[model samples]
Target: MKEVKAFAPATVANVACGFDILGFAVDSPGDEIEMKLVDKPGIVIKDITGDEGRLSRDPRDNTATVSVYQFLERIGAEKAGIEVVLHKKMPFGSGLGSSSASTVAGAFAVNALFDNPLTTEELLPFAMEGERVACGAAHADNVAPALYGGFVLVRSYDPLDVVRLNVPEELCCAVVHPHIEVSTKDARNILRGEIPLVDAVRQWGNVGGLIAGLEQENYDLIGRSLQDVIVEPIRSMLIPGFDEVKRAAIYAGSMGTAISGSGPSVFSLCRGMDKAERIAKAKVEAFKSIGIESDMFVSKVNKVGPKIIY
Candidate 1:
């Protein structure tokens, strides 16, 4: 059996206003997986790393392993018996698409080892099953960008058509991962079922503008459009120092700033690393100023998703 290696980057969902429908990738946050096809029937998970023993090898509890194996069973390839190992490059429950990145990498490694039995798009649902278990919501915004890369727009969730936009090379993102944990469930709980018509209109406008900004490479336009009247206001409350961090990012010349993936983690957009570094520092300081400790990732937009590295 041939050995295969696959990698996928973490994603930031809710990118401003397109909640559950929009996401973008960043460099630095990601996962890797290695797999080998075996002669035995059924898949067997072999190993894991970087998870600090928090992840499981059991199919039910293991996000990456379970998703890939179950998908194989669905396609009647369970007899192939794959041994897979996943490297968790990011923290679980970090709102950094940690599980999604692992799922994509593991799935791709297995699919590729077996000569790719499923189409790239077909692999989405299988991968999403992991998300379903992780977040209790099988949302595609994060996974789509983690798998496809660049700026992704989930046109429809039922069938999951993602439109990828060209991200300008100069675009930089500052991500602040708070030390505190906010489960996907708790974060979702804070959102209102129905928003006012005026708020909805404002959100839609921002969504349109974010999409346009990506296509046009307009930082100013993107910043203006990233505003949210509905989701952020509600979700922001869950994160301590949220308002301070956002304000600091903008003051530091960020084009836009918002919560990253049902977050306590907030991200900012800028045109250069220098600006991104400034933004990152400001966010960290904001968190500290409020007595909230956090870790920060200063990165640029990822143009590509899962791919072999080394």
Candidate 2:
């Protein structure tokens, strides 16, 4: 039996303007999974580690475990059973795309084990499937970038049109994962069903402008367009120091700052590593004052999505 290993990166979604359609990867943190096909006809999961006993091993409950099983079933495994192991290296509900990374690793591992019967592009739907089980909704904004890397402009879902933009440089960004959990379903429930037409128009304008800014590397324009009057204000109330942390990041010279996902985690884009570190520091201080412990990840924009570690 051939052993297949896969790794996937953590992601930050809701980059101010794109909301459900945008995300980027961060370096050093991710999830890994290994899989091998056996002669048995069923799928079995074993050897889970790294997560604080948070990830479920049941195929129906575990995002990574379900990914392998779904992919094998779709491709007709031909009497080959699956043995899977998950290394959930990222924290749950940290807005770091832990579940998405886990899903991506599992899907790619199974595909590679079967001698890569699917192309990378062909693999997205399977990854999407994995996320549906994980987050209730199949929002691929986080998963796509974690799986494929780089900034993505998800234009449509029916035909799945997304443009992978060239990253201008190894940009510095900071993630402050406050020691808190916001379930995906709760986050969704907090969102209002209706928005003013004027606000909708402005939101689309910002989304379009942000795309152009990224494409041209116009830092000023990008920062200006990173305004979210739609979702951030409503969700910010849930996080203890959201307002102060954002203000501190901007005052500390961050180009932009926003909630990472359905977050207690927040991210700041900065000029360099030093600025990123300072932003992380400011964020920690802001959270600590509110009685929340936080972990800071000083990372750059990760261009390489995922790679096998062994």
Candidate 3:
């Protein structure tokens, strides 16, 4: 194939209790990448859209371009000339796995052009490399779900192990992105390196319960288990009107709510679209009351991952 285009869905990382380990894909507000063979050697970024020129065009600095470059190098095709174009449908630094969507789209598209040399799992590391360039750390929570879809658990990073967890069909997600920028780097920096043993034990129990809830398809268990005593207490402070917004979501019938990825965006899980819509409106209104403009998305869990668009 001489050219290919693909779309990758946005992801919600952390998923409350399972920090750095759990995530799930959402339908809508993703990234698209198009790649075509070129006569010139090496990878070149031809164009970008919806990013307000905030993202770098240089291959070395851009996540999508860097991922495509790495894929070429892995296949011993570094000298193969290719041009890439990216369309960012989501806001950067909004904690919705914006960079991961782009990286996965680029890598997935380029791999399609080569008739698929790597499996979805195999494409993960390259995607994480792109994530590292953007966030200053190699994390699989966002990239894994964006690549594989549904709910994912990064059980172990030592051997790069990942598991696709079952998600109940009735479960829905509502997210609100406040008009504020919170860099992933800044969010990570604010986290304390160590937590008390008491908090650690509480966190461990909740994560285990969350996994069990997902496996058992028990919505109540999942909601009760979605407590985050470690990350949320600290990171929620960075988001304006976080407490009020979360309270509103819960009062509006959301199962549980937490900061999405690094923040400025918050997500809640609900049983159906009706509750999800109410939660979204409540969350948005709470932000507005605080003089913060926001955007809300209510969507079902995306079962399909990245796909070739053309």
Candidate 4:
């Protein structure tokens, strides 16, 4: 194929207990990219939408085009020219893995154009390179799930090991994105570099339980395992109405509530659509009560990651 258009779903990274390790994909509010072959060498950003001119037009600075450039270089196809157009359907800095969606869409579209030269795992590093440019960290919690879909675990980063985890069908996600921007850099900077051993042990236990719960399709265990003793304590303080929103979600029958990625956007996992909708409503109302406008998304886990649209 000479041209391909693809879509990558939005992802929730750091899923409470599994900080920098766990994430899952949601069905809506993602990014789309179209990659077309050209005669000139190198890639160019043809267009960008829904970003209100905040995103860079230069291919080197943009996450999606940067990923495409890296993919081309890795395949020894830098001499081949490509044009990429990005559509940012999700809000930026909303803890919704916006950059990851674009990066995955770009890399996946480029790979599809070349008749699939790399496996999904092989395409990860190229996508992570884009993430590093966008957020200053080569973390896979967001990108892995956006690329492979479902739930993912970043077992190790040194060698870049990632595993796709099982997700229960009844488990639904409710996410609320407040009308506020929180820089990922600022969020990372505010975190304490050290933690008590007791808290670390609790976090480890929760992470292990989460993994087992997912594998066994145990909804109650999953809810019980959704505990964050480290990051959320520090990060949620930066987000307005976070505490109120969490409490409201729980009262509305959510399994558990936590900051989605870093801050500003809070997510809850519910047992089904009915409870998910209730949690979304409660969270949004809580934010509104705190004088913040927000958008809520209720969805089951997206099983397919990035895919060709045309």
The C-alpha TM-scores of every prediction are 0.94, 0.94, 0.97, 0.98
- Candidate 2, which segments miss by more than 4 Å at Cα? none
- Tens digits of per-residue lDDT for model 1, 1-310: 2788888898899888888888989887789888887778766778888888888778667778767777777777766767778888787667788888987787777777767778877888878888887767788898888877888888987666778877987999999898888777887887899889988888899899888887898878888988878878888888888888889999999998998887878989889999999999999999999788888898889877888753
Worst 10 residues of 2 by lDDT: 162-171
- List model 3 lDDT by residue over 217-236, tens digit each: 89999999889999999899
Task: Name the regions of candidate 4 deviating beyond 4 angstroms.
Answer: none
Order by TM-score, highest first: 4, 3, 2, 1
lDDT of 4 by residue, 1-310 (tens): 9999999999999999998999999988899998899999878898998999999999999889888888888989888988888888999888999999988998999999999999998999999999998988888999999999999999999887899899898989999999999988899999998999999999999999999999999888999999999999899888987888899999999888999998678999988998899899999999999899999999998989888999
Residue by residue across 84-158, what tens digits does model 2's lDDT show?
A: 888877888788888899888988787777777887777788788889888777888988898788888677898
Better of 2 and 3 by lDDT: 3
Q: Distance (Å) between predicted and true CA of 52, model 3? A: 1.5
Native-to-model Cα distance after best TM-score fit, residue 165 in candidate 1, in Å: 2.0
Worst 10 residues of 1 by lDDT: 74-83
What C-alpha lDDT do the candidate models reach, one value each? Answer: 0.83, 0.83, 0.92, 0.91
| Candidate 4's TM-score | 0.98
lDDT of model 2 at position 13 = 89
